[model samples]
Target: MAQQAYMTETDNQGSGHEPRGTRIRRLMSRLANRLFAGGRDGRGIWRRGMVLTALAVLVGLIMLLHAQVPNTIGNSGSLIETFLPWLGVSVPVLLVLALVRRSATALIAVLFPAIVWLNLFGGLLGDKAGTGGDLTVATHNVNADNPDPAGTARDVAASGADVVALEELKTSAVPVYEKALASTYRYHSVQGTVGLWSKYPMTGVRAVDIQLGWTRAMRATVTTPEGQVAVYVAHMPSVRVKMEAGFTARQRDKSADALGEAIADEKLTKVVLLGDLNGTMNDRALNGVTSQMRSTQGAAGSGFGFSWPASFPMARIDQILVKGIEPESSWTLPETGSDHLPVAARVSVDTSS
Candidate 1:
């Protein structure tokens, strides 16, 4: 009897007793088996399918009308548009879940977001380096408080751009920039804080009134070997989103409207606009400008080149836009001593049109 009791105790310790973690895992396994049992059955498959379909529909809706959503909450629309490329992540995650659930319905639903995401941002996924252009133009917003004006000027001039448009020039640093770039660029024009330095002669220099009380924009005609190109350097009003106010860009919008009107009234055939517009092409607030000209990045660049906060670029506020020109290529330059990185575009003047 004693031997039998001891044997029974040993058996209980060896097999019947389970550690806390093991017990928990076993319970979870049982729960999973219960939940996933007969997963291919009608009700089980339908439930999983419905959940994935809901996810697919949600992603689709955001992709379709993300722009229509108001900026009432931290400029949510612009924020989403800024990081719009990230929306692709949802498709793969939903796909994995559908595969795990083994639901044909969910698997099919995953295709919706995948298709929508591809349609929206697929073009930006490939290499865009194809050919060179006749002219290379660059734009940079040297911060007003930039510590190295000479260095910034040197960096931009070294880019070998025939024309460079600079914005946010401070009163004290303008001379430094002028001296640094004068050796490389023979012709330069400045109006208010915005300036344009060109290797070719400049004409028709004037201040562009963006409804700002002071001058923050200018236009000049750069005479190149190929032909004459009208260039506009503009520094739009800055925008901010705060807890108290959401996407406060009233001033920037007004400035954009004024700039757009000026562009419409422009008599020149070949026109290029460069500056820190303080917004992306995706933002409807810049429709005034976007409606008039084509973004070089969209026309020729490879990916979504976000170029702001020079340390770690998150959104592209600097832009190079053109009308009546073919952009062979567009790209962002290395970071400079400014808050914004320089944006460059190589464009050929189609004088035939």
Candidate 2:
């Protein structure tokens, strides 16, 4: 009996008498051994991990340093920036590859690009709908060669937008649009190929020179129930990508500069610019205007809201920009008879503020 008791006591002492720090050290040692344990070729596993880590870091750098890319090559920097959100797709691809390889290093590396992409465009992915605003404004580039002008006009008018701006308004189809919109918009102003139709009274209507030699832009003041808001409509010269000349948008860039100067000189506090800018907001060619105004679509829309080539929209060239007004919501309307879709934004103009 004595020997049995001694043996039990000795076993208990051996199992439970170790110092807490010693036990913790032993546990950590086992974990480390397990984690570091690898296949027969340990170096190959580490090499793979290093490669994935490098790839992940590259992804993050590409997104964060995209602006450093030169625009001289067909304005490629702007083109990339316009589709910056797409870079996030690579993160998931890298993650899947990491899971397939079972590399902890690659998995850890993916966090960098994921965080970088989210930091760049996370806000844009969220739901942006808020309370409706005091005024809803819409814009469309009614293709100059539209097959059905009356149908296009009717579609736009049906939107019931308080203010509508139409660009690329051809001379032959002007009357059709006028007749179609006259009932809803009693106050209208047409300057060259651009026009503004308003539900409220309009004043200070005049053509604004965009250095385009012709009247392709106009500005007006609309006296709505909420307040007087300055409205400017423009159709920037089209840009083209040629094999020899690369991205040829010199004319559009010059026009943008002139438009910026015009807006800067305006005395009004509240302003909205609606038109086919012919360039995305990311394009440096439109930096003059983009710097001075906030894009309604970017501020409140649910998505990129590309409006060009209604059949297969690739970029959002049509824009609704505002200054001294709060955008409540923004969206793109369905395809009409025109080649381009309509874009709209609702803004709150708190005149008292």
Clashes in each model (backbone N, CA, C under 3 Å)? 0, 0
The Cα local distance difference test for each model comes to 0.86, 0.87
Q: Which candidate is the best by lDDT?
A: 2
Expressed as tens digits, the lDDT of each residue in 85-204 for candidate 2 is 778899999998876665778888999999999887787787696776899999999999999888888888888799999999999999999999998999998999999999999999
Local error of candidate 1 at 293, Å? 1.1
Model 1 spans > 4 angstroms off: 1-43, 49-53, 71-75, 96-107, 351-353
- Against the true structure, what is each candidate's TM-score? 0.82, 0.83
Q: What is the lDDT of residue 12 in candidate 2?
A: 59
Taking the tens digit of each residue's C-alpha lDDT, what string does model 1 give over 1-353?
A: 87677668866534555578977998998976664555445566456667788888888788888878787776778767766667888998988887677566787888888888888878877767548688999999999999899999999888889999999999899999999998999999889999999999999999999999999999998888888889999999998877787667888889999999998888888999999999888887888899889888888997877789889887888999999888888889888888899988889885453
Report how far off residue 60 is in candidate 2 (Å). 2.4
Lowest summed lDDT window (length 10), candidate 1: 37-46
TM-score of 1: 0.82
Itemize residue pairs with steric clashes in candidate 2: none
